[model samples]
Structure formats: C-alpha cells, structure tokens
Target: MSTLTERIDIQVKSRHELDEQLEAAVRELQEAALHVRARGILITRRLPGRYTAELSDHVPFGMTRELLR
Candidate 1:
C-alpha cells in the first residue's frame, strides 16, 4: 500500500510539472504569433506605397517617350 501511494504521488508531481511546461510553451507560441502578425501587418501596409512608387517611376519614362514621338 505504501509503495502504491508513493508511485501515485510521483505521478501527480510529474503531471503537474508537465502541465506547467505546457502552459509556458503555449504562452511563448502566442507571443511569437503576435510578433509574426505584427510583421505581416507592417509589410501589408507598406506594399501599396511601394507599388505606387514603382508605377510613378515608370510614368516619367512613358511621358518622355510621348514627347519624343
């Protein structure tokens, strides 16, 4: 009976430790996800401006060609 009780206690402690580690891992994953989402948002916000700049740079060339013709 004593040995059974001792085994049960050890199992409980191990399970508790595993639960804590799992919680910590979940928190870390959430933080990483937030950082990734923020970076994605930043990139998305900049895309339109970058595309407009590229288009604007080509406009002068087109205008110059029209003038030459």
Candidate 2:
C-alpha cells in the first residue's frame, strides 16, 4: 500500500505536469493569434479591384459582364 507521503508526491507531480501542459497550450494559442492577426492585416490591405477581377473569371454562362459593373 502506498503511504500518505507517497500519494501526496504523486499528486504533486501530476499537478506539475498539468501546469506544464497548460503553459504549452497557452503558448500555442498566442502563436496562432499572431498568425491570425497577420492574415487579417494582409486581407485588409487587398486591392479593391482584385475582387472584381476574380469574380469576372467565374461569371456564370449567361450573366452579362456589364451587370456586375
């Protein structure tokens, strides 16, 4: 049978491991946030005409191009 001290030690070790894992998860989240922020910045800077050009390439069979403009 495990003594009280041993049980306490085991619990402490488990808690420490959990804390480390939590820290790692937090770091990953922070990195992902930075990536998302960078992508948002890029999206905000897109040329306004780019959307029309992309849409023009995929116009439906019968849709008049003038309608879009």
Candidate 3:
C-alpha cells in the first residue's frame, strides 16, 4: 500500500512538470488563443537510454489513424 502511494505521488509530480513544459511550449509558439491539432510527436525507444522522436500526422484533422498502443 505504501509503495503504491509513493508511485502515485511520483507520477503526479511528473505529470505536473510535463504540463508546465507543454504550457511553456504553447506560450512560446504564440498560439495560445488558437487551438491547432494536426501534428504530434511520436517518441520511440531506439537504444538503451536513447530514443527517436518524429513529427507524425496522428492528430486528427479530418482523418483518423489506427492506434497500436
């Protein structure tokens, strides 16, 4: 029970940090007033401690894609 509580706390903290970072990105882009969803980042683990991130057209604009995950 204690372990689960600790894990939840850690996840909560991490999520908050990620939210802040995303907010900063949106603010820096200067598109705060407008909502645009067309592209996304797909990160995949390549090697140990290394990963590859690519700009994917997964964000539904007028089409859809199969979610494998």
TM-score winner between candidates 1 and 3: 1
lDDT ranking, high to low: 3, 2, 1
Q: Model 3 clash tally?
A: 0
Number of the top-ranking candidate, with TM-score as the measure: 1
- The TM-score values for the models, in the order shown, are 0.33, 0.33, 0.30
Worst 10-residue stretch by lDDT in candidate 1?
2-11
lDDT per residue (tens digit) for residues 1-69 in model 1? 211110011112355664564345334434443433321100111221121011112232222111111
lDDT of each: 0.25, 0.27, 0.34
Worst 10 residues of 2 by lDDT: 3-12
For 1-69, candidate 3 gives per-residue lDDT tens digits of: 211110011111355664564345434322311234554444343433333333345533333222222
The TM-score of candidate 1 is: 0.33
Where in model 3 is the C-alpha error above 4 Å? Answer: 1-37, 59-69
Q: Residue 42 of model 1: what lDDT?
A: 9
- Which should have the higher TM-score, number 2 or number 3? 2
lDDT of 1: 0.25
